[model samples]
Every structure is written in structure tokens, then in C-alpha cells.
Target: MTNGDDEGAAGARNRTVAVDGETFVYRRFGGTGSETVPPLVLLQHFRGNLDSWDPALLDVLAADREVIAVDLRGVGESTGRVRDNVTDMARDTIAFTAALGLRQIDVLGFSLGGHIAQELALLRPRLVRRLVLAGTAPRGGPDFHNWSDDLFDTSCLDNPTAETFISLFFSGSTDSVKSAWAYLARAGARTGDQDSATTLEVRDAQLQALMEWAIPDSSKLERLAAITQPTLVACGDNDTMMRTSNSNLLADRIPGAQLRIYPDSGHGFLNQYPVAFGEHVRKFLGQ
Candidate 1:
């Protein structure tokens, strides 16, 4: 991932591309790498847009490879209403990539985007050259019980204050809480563009999806074995929302997948530790 300062100066050029009858906003940066290097496709988390990704992180990753981050449908500047579930969103991503005429690209997906990325690889294995799943899970199983409906309802639709988000998403530690809040304030201020109503709707729909979601079971996990691309599964050691064990399960289930655990961080590990996060991803893709 690229650093913030460098990203502001040299990140990919910004543009809007059409996918699945909808226009999506995307940023493309860095094309000076070796000819053999595939372009990198970045996927953002739930309710997040391209801007939600740290510019600095993007800059770092873009230093050696072409990086493209897109706004998923119903989020950011992309057109249409947000989908009600991850499968539909994943389909949208596949359509988005096909529309761009990309063949064999390295992909990094965070949180909700990670789920979608996995679906994309399962649905179209030939297109993904490498895969990274961060702060996410293979399925929305019983693990989501840690998050309360009230908390989910509160955090989803309204642009939550840093304190509120930290309380809900991070482990209840002073340092973690403080850092989470700070990151939230900074990221939210920089990337937060949700209106009250839109935020609320997005939140409600996302929670509804999660509350009703079920992992595709053994059959789906078996399908993951069909993914031939090198895969990395990572999460913060302290992520209360999605435990490190979840990432381990994904790694163990996916044939030849690598697992990385970031210490002293929570769900937003990428933002909390961008340099390390970018390095892990860069190395994975390099392999």
C-alpha cells in the first residue's frame, strides 16, 4: 500500500468506469513496474469507498505495482442502491473487473470486501492472479454473535463518532480504544461522506445481511480449494469483531493459503498498521 503523502502526489489517476449498467469511481496508480508484474486491484470494506482506503497505504503498494481501488455499487460515487448481501456485491465486483478488460490481476480485499473477493475467486478463478483476505471471514457464521444488534444498528447507518465505533469494534482496552478512536476520526474525516439517511440505510441493510447470513458450509469451503492463486489470510490479533481464529480457519481450509496475524491491533488493522499491512500484502503478491 502507498503512503498518504506520496499517494496525494502519485497515486493512480482518478476516473469513473461503467460496470453492470452502473458507473463506478476508481483510482489507478503506478504503472512503471516490471512488465511481468500484474496490476493490483484493491477492494474496500463494507460501506467503504475507494477513499476509505488509506492513501498512504495505496501509495506504498503503488510504489512497485499498478494499483486500482474502486467504489462498490451503492457506496461512494458509484451509482445504484447498495446490494442487500455479499453475494450480489461479489457479482458486481466480477462484472466491474470484466468491464475493465482486466485479465489476471492481484487482488486485496478488506473486511466485507474480503468476503466479496473470495467469492470472485471462487466464481472466476482464472482472473485472479493473487489474493489477500484481511480483517474478514470465509463465512458469516456464529462468530458474528460478538456484535450486538443494538451496536450494529447504531454503527451501521450513521457516520458513527470515533468513540462509538471504537466501543463497538475494538477490544475494550485503553490503548486499543484510544488508537481505534483516533483512526476512526482521521479515516472518517478523510473518507466519511455518508449523509445521515444514506448512512442509516446502508447500516441497516448491512446488519440485516449479516444477521441473516450463513457460511456456504463444507461445499463452499471445498470450492475454495479450487482457487489456484496464492492466497493470504490476515487479521489483527486483537480484533474482537472477527477473531484471529477466524482467519486461521480460512487459512487452514484454503489449500496452500498463508496466514498472518498482526499484533496489538483490532479490526482496522490496515489503518492501524498500514506499513506492515502493505508489506504483508506486497510480499504475498510478489510470491
Candidate 2:
């Protein structure tokens, strides 16, 4: 990836890396990490792209280390078929980092991106130094096979408006709703040279992967034990998407993993409490 001149996430321009005949678009912001800190690879949530990341969170996390968020294969400006399974998606992420010559890096994955992060750590343990799993669950995690009957109902929609995000990612509390709006306002700051909107095809492909991962199978939970790197499992106390208990399960299953749950928040806890969470992460990874 070419060096970016912009200083923050909102101003960071796009960069590309061609690997395996496919071009992947990514944004690398923040200056180099201080001391031994490595670059942090950010994985976007489901139906989200490079631009979908919360700028405030990125800016805070980048205060001490470089941050790189990439559009998943076949999503945003990236070119390729969207993989229908999390494992293949993880492989694509591996290829993207390998092409960039990243031998070892820290990772922060949100929602579906967290699923990919877990897979990445397990797929190539030595490649990742530290991990942060936000608003996500392990395979066969809580509420498995019962996410919601209308999951695809929203999936097929062409526009996921601000309200849609609020309903799904935020809690019903008055303060949480206000936080949602604030996060939305910050997220909209990036305008020029923006990444492409997520298409229905990419949505459906990721949905299929989610369904496959949500299938009822107790054996799948055991796979998380393979993750050997230092990890932080985080989410809101009222996560309707992945369920709060799932984050607890992830903390339990992953050896020596730390768990943090923000009260009065929902799936978008990191965005809601970006400052606290960002510092939490900075401290965790800095160690």
C-alpha cells in the first residue's frame, strides 16, 4: 500500500494493492506506530466498507499507531467475487496483508469483521500480534441459528439509512440514541474520493456467510481455542445482533482473552464509547 499523506481517517485517501489478479482498495491513516507498536489492521462490519469505519474511533486508535482499513473483496471499490464463507473471506484478508508485505500486525474487527478476525488469527497465528473482537461472536456462539427471521428482510434493502443503523446498532435508551446520531455525524465527514456504496450482491454474499456461521453446531465453539495471540473481546451489554452473551463466550473460550462490555449501549458500543474503548485498545496493544 502506498503511504498516505492525510493525517486522519476522514481525510485519508484510498490506496490499492493488486494480488492474485484482484485489486484491493484500502486506506492507511495515522503515522507510524511509536516504538514497538505495529500497524493495526481494521476489518469492517457486515454491509460496511472502508468508509463505513467510525472516524472518531479510527482517529483515537491512530493516535499512537498506524491504522489500515480495507474494503473486503468484491465490496466497495475492491474487485473480486464476495466469498460466501468466513474462511474464504479470511483467506482474502490474509492475501491482502501478505501483498502489502505485513509480516505481523495487530487487528481490530467489528461485527462480521470480528468473525473474520478470529478466523485470521486461527488461520495464521504468527501473522497477528494482538486482536480486538468487537460486536461479534465465535462460531456456534449464543443465539446460534436464531438471529432473527427478518435478517434478510433488511439485507435486500437498497438503502440502509441512518435510522436503520440506529435501530440495529444502537440501543433504545435516550442517551444511546443521541450517541448514535453523534457517531453518524462523525461518520459522514468523509466525502471526497469516497469508497463505492455496498451493493446487494455483496450484502447477500455476506448474509450467506453469516447464515452458514450461525448454524446450530456446538462443536464450532471449540475452534476458538486455537487462537493463541493476545485478544480483547468487546461489545455492548445489549447487543441484539450478536447477543451480549456471545462476547462473554468469546472471552471464555479464547485463552487469556479480556472482555469489556459497555453499559447502556448496543452493537455499536465502540463507536458510542470511542474514546474509552480506543484508549483501552491502545493500552492493551501497547503492552
Candidate 3:
């Protein structure tokens, strides 16, 4: 195991494993509690690392079940060339799960991770015991550009500024924006190491994938019904990038899928309101 300094204040335990010729690092919490509880697998959004997830949120969820958050390929401590699409990342996820010997785990994904989660559930329905998708869409389409110019222009990848990244995550009215900025600043301060090449490659691959990939059509929607696992679809009412309506549509389409909407929240609602998000997730996974 390649060990690094523990981000102690966060209370996250990090571990690295070899999966499909890559070194994938994951942070785990609460898995050691008891054998009766099932483990939860967490998937982060685009360019997100394990540290991107709130440690407090994982701690809360761990009270009832073990929580595992992964840093996807080409991100954080995970190794591999930059992936071109969600499919590659999804494959990496499957490989990681298999390598870790995790069977029938509850799965949760947010934003870009949500997209990959959907693909994973569809591809390997038996591996997932339950599913939760936050601020995610079934298929990327015209909705990708639904955000206001102000919001779109504030994207961190396009212009890497502390303010731009912070604004892209949550609504201006969110009180946690300061904390979000602090987190981003800490993450940014650790940037530009030997892993800089990996970050750039990942960014380029993501851009290329976004430009060329088209979401599978409504035909793929039929597969959601085939998924026997209990599924939850959630989004913030104020989500601008992916409309709440899209989440509703997904919930309505999938058999027995539950939908929840956070009031006055945006795309990054999970991080914006970790306590509420963790509560909802805990209940759903516990069921």
C-alpha cells in the first residue's frame, strides 16, 4: 500500500489497491463497525477525488453501514491514463469493486459519478444491491447546456480560479460557500506535483469525451425498468445544469424508483448539505 500523510482533520482512512493495472486509492469509513451492516460505495463527480467528499458525511453514514469513496481513474491517487468517457470510468469502478472483493454493495453517485453509476447498474445489475443518484441525468442531451451563461462561464476547468470553482459548485445564497472555498483552496494548494501530467491528461480526456459522446437514447431508459435493485433518484430544486425534472423523469421511468428533491439547492447539493444528504442516503440504503 502506498501511504501518504493522512488528512487528519477530515477523519478519512485512505488505502490504495491495484485494479486493472492501475493504482486506485479509496477512502473508507465505518466499515469496521459490525458485520450486520452492508457497505456503501460512493462515486464522486467529474474531476472529484476521495477528499472531495465530506468526511463528516461519510462518518454519519458509517454509523449504520460502512462507506467507501473512490477516486476515479486519473484523478487523485488513482493511476491510469485519462479516460475518454464514462464507460471507461465505469469499467474502472467495476474492476475496483471486483479487486476489493466487494459483493452486492449499495451504490451512490453524484453528478458525473451519477452518470457512471447508471451505466454500472445497467451493465451489472446483480452487483448493486441498491442505487442512489444525486443531481444526475439518465442521458446527456440538450439539457447539458441548460445552465445560464453566468453559471456556465463560472466553470473551474475553463478558468481555474478559486472563485470560479466555488461558484460552480453551489448557489451564491449557500452559507457553506465559504467552507467550500476553503476546501477547494486546500485541494488546489496540493496541485502541480509529479501527478500534474495525470491531471492534465484526465482533463483533456474528459473534454474530448464531452465533445464527442452522446447519451444513449430512450431505448436505454427501458433498461432502468429491468434493474431489480431499489433505486433512488435525487436532485436539488434549483439545479441548473441538470434540471430537477430530469430526475423526476428518471424516477418515474424506473420501476419502484424513489425521487427526492432538496429545496433551493443546486447541482452540488450533496456537498452543500451533507447532513441532509447523508440522512436521506442512510435511510434509503438501510431499507
Candidate 4:
């Protein structure tokens, strides 16, 4: 449980709760400030589980307020069928919060997680206080629909190696790759009670969700207007997976949303710039 903020993410225990007959695994930690600051909920990328969160970044974000990182249904040790659409995923998350008795929360969604976060905020506006969208895009925006040929060539393998993730999240530049390896090392530092890997079912379902959600409809941008919560959109300067242009568009669409672009990074820029980005997030959250 990481009481008294002893060691942050790596030391946080895996907790369980039953939501609609589904046992969900999650890590809850760092709830150490005024009650006015709501907890932050993390939504992972496609095929990512609770362990997918970079410990360094988690520690940064959890410094003041509590952070809840879950394994979404059918991923990792969570017991349920993974859905083929973000709406169901969001619904599952909403149910999860109800089971935990959380009335208000802040959300940080990365990659495909960003999709679910958007729907969550829209569907349950009063529940979500603020939003952080990283390495993601809006519904039906440029470079949002479909995967690139390079991405198609690498993703959805039965087993993925460190190199597979390194290339997928960072650019091929010498520095970017170097940072990626460092991130891998830090993210893997948790020694015991680690989370399980996401299954192929989760992969296929998330891919199908992306296919349906990112179908480039400019008119859909109107949906962002409904998100009156303070928002922060962040990404790398060169995110091939979710192009940086999408960040610009996302921030533009969401009234008063701020955008940040990390230099010389890609989709995993938050991990690469954990210290800076974490501080930035904490400041934005203002705990």
C-alpha cells in the first residue's frame, strides 16, 4: 500500500477490488496531501498493464496526491473480457471507481488510454476533475486513424522484446534510443510482486477499438467543447505513433487546454523527461 510514501511506485502493493464479478488489480499510493486534491488515475497504452507504468514517472506524479494505476479488464491479472471499443473500457473504469467509492478523480491517459480517458471525461463529466492526454489524439483527427506500415510490421507479436518497445516508443536517433534504454531499465526496477503481461486478446481488442475510434471525422472535434475541465495535452516533438500534430489539434480543440512538446523524443517522452514532465504535471495539477 506504500503507506507514508515510503518508496513510491516500486514499493506500492498490488491491491484488488471486485467490480461486477471481475477482480481488478491496481496500485494505490502517495495519497499524502490535503483532501481537496483528488487522486490521479492512470490509463495505459495498448497492450500495457499496471507494470507498464514507468516507476520514475509514477513517483513524480504521485508525490503529493494518490495515484491509481489499473490493469484494465482482460489485461494483466484483471479478470474480465477486454472490450473492442473505448466506450466499454471507460464504462468498466467507471464501475471500478464506484467499487472503490471514489467520487472525483483526475485522469492521465497515454496512447490508446488517452482515447478511453476522453470518453470517460465526456460520459462522466462530474467524476473527472482534470485531464492529461499524452501520446494521443482526439476522435477522428489527422494521423489518428490506422497504424503506419512500420507499426503494423512490429506490433501485435506473440512476444515483444525490449528492442521492440524501444523502437516503438522512441526515435532511432542515438540519443533517443539511449534514453529509451534508460527508461526500460527504470521501468523494470520493481523487483517483486510485479504485474502480468497483457494477453493477445487485449492487443486485438485495442486494435479494433483504434480502428473504430480514430476514423478521421473533423466534425467530431465538436465533442471536445463539452470537456470544460482544465486539460493538459502533452507528447514528444516527433511521436510517430500518435503524431505531434495531434497534440496541437487536441489542445486547440479543447478550450483552454495547454500543450507541451518534449524535445528530441517520441511517444514515450513522458518517461524520457520524467523529472521535468512530472514536475510540470504536478504544477498543473497544483496539489
Winning candidate number (TM-score)? 4
How well does model 1 score by local distance difference test? 0.70
Residues 144-188 of candidate 3 have per-residue lDDT tens digits of 643456754554254366566566666667565765665455444
Tens digit of per-residue lDDT, candidate 1, span 200-280: 556566655554444435454565667677899988887666567778878988889999987777787787777778887
Global local distance difference test of model 4: 0.88
Tens digits of per-residue lDDT for model 4 on 93-196?
Answer: 99999998889999999999999999999999999999999999898887757777878667777898999988888877898888888888887888877988
Question: What tens-digit string does per-residue lDDT give for candidate 2 at 1-287?
Answer: 32544568888889999968999999887867533678899998888988778888888898877898999789999999888899999999999999988888899999889999999999999989999999998888758456565654543568888877788888878999999999888888777769998898898899888878878677998998899899999999998888899999999999999999999998889989988999999999988
Error of 4 at 104 (Å): 0.7
lDDT winner between 1 and 4, please give it: 4
Cα RMSDs of all predictions?
3.8, 1.8, 4.1, 1.6
Better of 3 and 4 by lDDT: 4
After TM-score superposition, what is the CA distance of residue 104 in candidate 3 from its true location, in Å?
1.6
Q: Give the 10-residue window scoring lowest on summed lDDT in candidate 2.
A: 147-156
Ranking by lDDT: 4, 2, 1, 3
Q: Supply every candidate's count of residue pairs whose N, Cα or C atoms clash at under 3 angstroms.
A: 17, 0, 0, 0
